[model samples]
Target: MMSGLRRGPLASRFSPSRQAAMKQSVKLIVGNWKMNGLSAALAQAESIREAVGAAGQGHRVVLCPPATLIDRMRTALAGSGVAVGGQDCHEKPVGAFTGSVSAEMLADAGATVVILGHSERRAAFGETDAGVAAKVEAAIAAGLEPIVCVGETLEQREAGDAIAVVSAQVEASLPTGLSERDFAVAYEPVWAIGTGLTPTLEQIAEVHAAIRAAMVKRLGESARTAPILYGGSVKPENAADILATPEVGGALVGGASLKAEDFMPIVKAAA
Candidate 1:
C-alpha cells in the first residue's frame, strides 16, 4: 500500500500545469548515495518508498546506491514505483579491471539507471568524456538508462562559459543515437553540489533549456522528451521552485539525499 499525504499548495497549484508538463515532464529525483551505505542504508529505501507513496505520483524517484547495495535496494524498492540505479559502471563488460563493475553486471544486479561522468569521477578519477561515452554506450547496451552528468566549475560560470563548457561535455559524453528511454542528462554545476549555493531560477532555466536545445539538435524529437535534471545545492526548500521552473524536470540530490527526513520534502516538491 502507498503512503498518503495531504497535497500542500505547492502540490495543488501545479496540478493542471503539472499535468501538462507530465506529457513532457521527465522530472527525476535521483539519490546518489555515493560511497556511503551498507546493509543499514537499505532502510532509507523504505523511507524513500514511503515518501514517494505519500507524495502520490508527480515525479520519478530513483535511488543509486553503491554497487554493494544495488541488489538489496532493488529488492527493497520492488513494486514500490521507485527506481533503483547504480552510482557508476565500467565501460567494459568483461576485463582485467579488478575493482570495476561492468554495466552488464549492474543490469544483472537489477539496476535500471546508472550515473555517468559525475564531476567527482571526472576530477578525482580523471575520467574523460570519451571514457564516459564508452560507459554510456555499455549502459545502453545492457538495457540501463544512463543519467549522464555534465557540469562546469565556478570559474567557468564566472567566465561566462558555463553553457559552452556544458554543451561540449553533453555533446561529447553522449553516445550517438540516444533515445529518451536510453538516457537522461543532469546539469549539476560542479561548484554547486553540497555547497549550499543554487543558481537563480533563471540561471537554472537557461542552462536546462540549453541542454534541451542541444538534445533536440542531436537526438531530434526524442531530445525534447528527454528529462534534463538539475543538480547542485538542491534542497527540500528549493526543490519546489527549481522543479517548477521551465525545462527543469527534476533534481540530482547530493548531500541532502543522505537522510530521509531531508530528502523526502524534496521528493514531495518534485511531485
Candidate 2:
C-alpha cells in the first residue's frame, strides 16, 4: 500500500440509476483473487479498507475472491468502499451443474460484479465467445454487473491479428442485451498476466481504441462512454502510467492485488 493513499468514506448506496451513470467516473480498480485465499487473507482486505477508507468519488474498488470467500469478504468489507465480486459463474441460475456456481448464487453471496471470458477461462477451460455471451446475459439476469473481458495471445499479436482477434471477441462475447445494462470490459493481454511484461503505452492505447470502436458499433454512440480497463501486470510501479493512457479508465489487477500495500498505490494512482 502506498502510505500516502487515503481511504474513502463508507460504501455508498448503489442504485440502478447510479449504476447506469457510473460511466461518468474514471478509476475502477478490481482485484481478481483467482483460486487463492484462505480466511486469513481477510487481513489484507482490512488493510485495504483502512488505506482507501475515504477514497475519492472518481475512484472505485472491488475485490473478486474465490467463491468460498465472497460472502465472508463481503461481510468483512461491509462498510468499506471496496466491493466484493466473483471470478466466474455458470450461465444458468439453477441447474444440476454440480460444482459450478451461477451468477444468481454469486449475487446472493454478495457479488455485485462477475468476470467472464477471462483469458484463463478461454484458454484453460475452452470458454468460447458464445459461452461468454451467455454468462454476460446471466450476470444481468441475476442483477450483477459483468466485467466482460477480451484480449489477445502473444501468438495472435505476433501474427498481426491482435486488433482483429479482440474485435471479433468483443463482437461475439457481448450481446445486444447489454445495451440496456451497466457493465465494464477488461483488456487483459494474455502474455502479460503474471509475466512481468506489458504492452507499450501506444500498444495499450491501440487496443483500447479498437475496443471502444467495436463497442460503439455494438451499442451505438453511447458506447464511447464505456470503461475499457487494462488488465495483466498492473502493479503500483506502472499503474500510474497505464491508467494515464487515453482509454484506460481503470484496471483489472491480478497478483499485485493480493496485498493492500501493493494494491493501494495502484488505487491511489487512479485517484
Candidate 3:
C-alpha cells in the first residue's frame, strides 16, 4: 500500500492476509456505453472479447451498453470472460412505471451487472441518494452486482466541498446489503464526463483516499476490500497512472470505451 493510503487506522487490527486482500482486490475495467451502441456495435464487443482472451485474469472487464443491447451483447460476448451490464435500472422489481427497466429485467436479460446512481442519472433525472440506495437493494435482490456511483460537481469542487459532498453520497447512496454482495463505488466528477477534462493525478488520489475512508466508516472491514473506481475522462493515455493510484481499484470508462481499438488499451492498462 502507498504511504498513507492504507484502508484506515482500523486496517491494522485485521489479520495480515485481510490487510493484503484490501489492496489485492481485482482491478475492474467497466465500459459505460451509456445510451450508445446498436446491433452493429456487437462487432466491437466481439473484438474486445477476442483481444481480451486471458488478459483479464487478475482483473475484470465489463461492458455496459444501452438497455436495447444488453441481451444481444451478453449473447455475443458469452463465455468470453467479459461481462455484460446495464447503464441503469429501476428500483422496483415490477411496477406500473412505464418505460423503466427494473433490476430484475436487467438480470433476466442476461446482465450480470448494473450501473446505478451515475452523475448523469442524478443531474439529468434528479435522482437522490435515498433513491440510489433503494436501487442498490433492488440490484442485489435481482442477483446483479451494482456499480453505485457518487461524485461532486465542478462547482462543489471549486467551493472546496468535493470530499464532503462525496462522503455524504457514500454514506447515503449505498445500502447495507452491499456488505455481503459484490458491489463497486464509482466516483465520476460531473464536469469531467464527456468533456475531455480530468482531475490531476494528485487530486484523483486525494478523492479516492477520501472515498476509501468514507466506505470504511460506513461498512467497516467489509468496505475495505470493495473496489473504489475512478471515472471521468478516463482513457488509454491516462489509464495506467489513474489505475496505479493508491485507493483507485479500477475505472468506469465512458466514451473511450465505445470502441475496441480505444477500449482495449485501457483494459490492458488495468491488467
Candidate 4:
C-alpha cells in the first residue's frame, strides 16, 4: 500500500490480496455492461470473482455494470479480486437532473472507477468535448478513476484521417491535472463497436501508438505510461493478439464481459 493512503469505505472492503493487486501498475480489463444486467446477474459476478481469484494473476479486473447494479455488485464482490464501476456519470455532483447519475453518486454507490466520453454518449446525447473534460474533473474529485474514451468513425478511417481524428479527440476530451495513478484511455473505434468487426493488428497498433504520443503531448509525460486500452468487438479469438500488440495496455470488453465464461479467456490472454 502507498504510504499515507487512507483506506476509505471502498478500499476498506477489499481483501488484502486484492488490495495488493490493485497497487500494481499493469494491464487492466474492464467490462462495460452497458445498460444490461439485473439482480440475478449477480451470479455472474460471483462466477467472475471466483475465476479471477483462483487464477491468482496480477492483472486488475473491473466490472462496470449498469447504475442500478453498482451497489449490489460492490457488496457481492467484497473481499474479492474484481472491482466495480459505473458506465457513465454526469458532470455535476448533485442536481434535479431526473434520470441522470453524477460522479459523486457513483462514488457513494461504491464505484472506484467511471467510464467517460464514450463514443456512444457523444453520438447519442451529443456530449461535447468540453462536457467530457468537466466529467473527468468531476470523476477525479469524487475519488473515482476515469477511463476517458477517444475514437474515430468508419468515415474518418476511409478518408485516411483516423489518426488525426483520434489524436484530436484525445487532446480535447482528456483534461489536464491527471497522472498514471487515476485514469485510463480507451480507443474504441465508433465503426467497429458490436459490428463483429475490428481494426487490423497493424491498424490497432498504429492508433494506440498515436494515442500514446497524443497523451504524452496532451497530458504530459506521465501519460506515456498511462493505460491505453482497446475496445470494440473484443472477443476470445482476437484477445491474445490484441493484448500482445505494442502500446495496447489492455481492453474494455463489451458483450463478452457480460458472462464470466466468455470474459475469462480474455483475462487469461492478458495474464
Clashes of each: 1, 11, 0, 0
**TM-score of every prediction relative to native:** 0.90, 0.91, 0.92, 0.90
RMSD to native, candidate 2:
5.7
For residues 83-192, could you state the per-residue lDDT of candidate 2 as single tens digits? 89999999988988989999989999988888899999999999999999999999988988889999999999999999999999998999898884567889999999
What is the Cα-based lDDT of residue 56 in candidate 3? 53
Error of 1 at 122 (Å): 0.7
Output the lDDT of residue 155, model 2. Answer: 96
What lDDT score belongs to each candidate, Candidate 1 first? 0.83, 0.86, 0.86, 0.85
Local accuracy of candidate 3 as per-residue lDDT tens digits, 1-271 = 0011244677768785676465556688899998888899999999999999946555788999999999899899887878988888888899899999999999999998899999998999999999999999999999888898999999999999999999999999988777745788999999899899999999898998898888878877667777889999999899999988878889999999899999988888877
Which 10 successive residues of model 2 have the least lDDT summed?
2-11
Per-residue C-alpha lDDT of model 1 across residues 144-245, encoded as one tens digit per residue: 888999999999999999999888888888878575444679999989887888889999989988887777776665455567889898888888898899
Q: Is candidate 1 or candidate 3 better by TM-score?
A: 3
The alpha-carbon RMSD values of the candidates against the true structure, listed in the order shown, are: 6.0, 5.7, 5.0, 5.6
Tens digits of lDDT, candidate 4, 181-245: 55789999999999999999999999999998898898665565467899999999999999888
lDDT of 4: 0.85
For model 2 the TM-score comes to: 0.91
